[model samples]
Target: MKNITCIEDLRQIHKRRVPKAFFDYADRGSYAEETLRANRSDMERIKFRQRILVDVASRSLNTTILGEPAALPLILAPIGLTGMQHSDGEIHACRAAHAAGIPYTLSTMSICSIEDVASSVDKPFWFQLYVMKDRGFVKALIERAIAAKCSALVLTVDLQVIGQRHADIKNGMTVPPQWTLSKFIDFASKPSWVSGVLRGKRRTFGNLVDAMKGSNVNELSVWIASQFDQSLNWKDVEWIRSIWPGKLIIKGILDVADAKEAVKTGAQAMVVSNHGGRQLDGAPSSISVLPEIVQEVGGQTEILFDGGIRSGQDVMRALALGAKSCMIGRAYVHGLGAGGQDGVATAIDVISKELSTTMGLCGVNRIEDIDRRVLTDHLQTNAVSSPRN
Candidate 1:
């Protein structure tokens, strides 16, 4: 705790806490790893122009996401099996995010169910849904979210087909970890993780297990694999919109054409993402194509950005280039994997301070005032030239 200062610091601690297999699942990416590497590198390439002598004392990181006030311009993006990262991880992350005044999104494949988080937290959190082939179960999931009073319904338009992660195939990853001879060796080294998981409320996918009675991890994986609807299309958004009356956010938009189509779905906001470089191995990094997508649909629909956002400086860069807000996945997962709820709280705290400092250095007093003027001329030409609506 005394040495923790950044998200990567927690990441190293997390690596030491969890088993090698689960850590690789969260940390690695799809085949060839080109897009995964590019996500971070591309963000790093964007330079900033510093300004001083402009009343730098006062600054604000306060902003809004889908009409709800936030402590900062950040949201915890959904990550599957977050509960496996640390016992009851989703609940801990939700409480920490709610306490920090930012939104937390629960994944459809989370180890903790929707009801589990709704019952624990006082305020409503966002929910992320993967459109499955099982429309009946999908509709039931939507009703569950509505019944829990979720503030927003994030429709992840990507991952209609699962990306082949080489690490996952090699590790033999499962929901409730199977302690085979190979896994046993890995689990033996992670006593803390095992103890925490053994003491947790639920081990396997809490949302799916009851519904999938008489099924084990192998069967559950097979069922989930068959559920990803390769035929998912824009019409599904209309169907979802008909059922979910709350704010709808279409995530995983990376192309200008897709951004235009997303706006037609009547969504309040759309996240410009490439699935954190997890799917489509050779796709352009989310940050690189953000300006193009924003330019095509900037005024039509609010654009939220994700992928390769590790620091508050990255957050300011995305916002300056026409993103209304940014979502973080690996950063908070590092916190959760490293130190449970306290680590998550610390991750938010670190980013808040960094974003505030970056804002002040760029001569802005409020997050709303951030624009391309803060960027170098080169970035300005390549990025959105104006603020987003």
Candidate 2:
């Protein structure tokens, strides 16, 4: 723990500690991974304007997300199968987020159900919903989230049609992981991971117990895969908005038109994301489209950024471009896989510290002070490129 200094360190430990399938689930991107690589590359292309001899006194990272005070302008993005990364992973991750004074979103496909996580955590975390073909079940899930007192509802608008991730097919990834002789040997190599998962509260998807009742692993996997509704549209968002009387955040808007439409849904916030490069392999990077989306709808609704955010500097970059806040998926998941709750805490600490240091280096003292001025002129001039149009 003392040796852990950066998110990459945690990622390396995560890859080594967790099984290959689960680690790759967080690491790999869809199809050819062109967009996945672009997410990071475009972020790197923007350079920060460093300042010197500024008042080196007090600095703060506090801000409000969704009309609520937060320790930082960051949220733990919902990652499905989180519990598979570690034992009771959602609960642990939520606890870590609460301890850090930030919001943690539980995925619809989590191993720990809303009730499970709500009971375990002291604070009200956010919930991410995937509107499936079953409207009844979708309403029920929203009702459950309401009952659990979730502070926000993150409706993922992308993923109406699933993308093909060849690694998942090759790895044969599934809930409760089907075990072959090779898998057994791999599990044997990571005895600690095996033990933790074996002693976990539920090996299968905890939220889908009723839906998957009396079904075997193969059938359950098939059912889960087929649940992504291709018919999803803005009307479904309206339906969900009617049921969920809380802060609504629409995730996965990469186009200016989509951003405008998401704001029209009466969502309090919308995320500029490309599903972490997990969908639409040829699409533009989230960062590349962020400025344009902000230009079109920055005032109409709060814009949150996601994709390729592994460091505090990355968070700063997004905020400078117009993201009111940021969401992280794989960064903290690496910490979770590496060391569970403590690892998660470490991941948060690492980023927060780096963000603070970066803030001071860039001559900013408050979150509100971060804007396009912090970026190099070259990036600002070349920002609106083919991606934005």
Candidate 3:
């Protein structure tokens, strides 16, 4: 217990340090959470085929995401309200990721603004955009990202409709948290988290503050719900691609039909995600659907997988299944919540070590060499056999 070794250690520590509501926000999924549970369970069921008597030294996790070199085939996924996790949470996570040689994604709904992360980190990070009905604002947002020199523009295509996470509504989740008696009492108990929150300034949604004319919480709520474009379609992607001349990544592709459509968009990459199982409760887990999507459009577009990624082996599983890279949302969030930038670094370290060691045991030294042959009996038939170049 003294030496934290796994993500669950961070999550348990995070659960005690932060308010229950925010923890639930990061940890829980949609109604019933069947898909959320499945993400992990299905991944665990994929038993690895242990190999030996092969040279295992000099293993590497280095790979490219969207053609950019990464120290590891992992990206710190964008999660909203990261600042609440541990003062300037996005900035801390960015710093940790940069140091760890992985890319960090900043969310549109992040507590820290786009500029905040841009100014804080030295290297270019990815920016995730939630298509809003306000074309004018969306255009400006794109310009801002361009101005910040964000390396990639990640277009999150899944959240046209926000799924109802029962815990969030029940907890009355809000940024610059509302101080109801129970919530206040819970918040008061965690002095470390409170200190972090108080010491920092970018508390609420920083990107929206100036854009919404510094609107208050209630007004901001109205603006958000009204702005999320419910009618987002392929036409809009063309519109965005025309305007934003940069590497484009479409997040949240779960179906073969949708994956095929996404490939035709000329997107350099697509994340196979179900919004971390937060959108549709009964939908299949990201790993479960990854192979089908790969079969549909594997070589046509770069495939990045997300949802229920807990460890380095999870990363290995995804790669063998044809994913070029994997994104960890809750895994690193647990780290961030548990110990800020240190926690994030720790999360990355744990995964990197796990991945390298797993590769050694599997007789795969280079990440690029990881193929379907390393998987158990049933998976070898469908696994990618070799990582994509």
lDDT of 1 by residue, 1-389 (tens): 55789999999999999987889889999998899998888788777889989997778788888787899999999999999999999999999999999999999999999999999999999999998888999999999999999999999989998889999889988887777898898788899899998988888887777667998888998898898999999999999999999999999999888898888888999999989888999999888788877777889888999999898999998998889999999999999999999999989988898899888888999989998788886544343443233
Looking at model 2, which ten-residue stretch has the lowest summed lDDT? 380-389
Q: Which model, 2 or 3, shows the larger TM-score?
A: 2
Q: On a 0 to 100 scale, what is the lDDT of residue 208 in model 2?
A: 78
| Runs off by more than 4 Å, candidate 2 | 378-381, 384-389
TM-score ranking, high to low:
2, 1, 3
- Cα lDDT for residue 183, model 3? 94
Best by TM-score: 2
Instruction: Compose the digit string of candidate 2's lDDT tens values, residues 1-389.
Output: 78999999999999999988889999999999999999998898888999999994689999999889999998999999889899999999999999999999999989999999999988999999999888888899999999999999999989999999988888888887888887788888999998998898888887777887999989988887889899998988888888999999999998888888898899999999999999999999888888888988999999999999999999999999999999999999999999999999999999999999999999999999999888886654365332254
Which pairs clash in the backbone of model 2? none
Per-candidate Cα lDDT values, in order, are 0.89, 0.91, 0.88
* Candidate 1: clashing pairs of residues: none
Q: Which ten residues in a row have the lowest lDDT in candidate 3?
A: 380-389
Residue ranges of candidate 1 with Cα displaced over 4 Å: 378-389
Judging by lDDT, tell me the better candidate of 1 and 2: 2
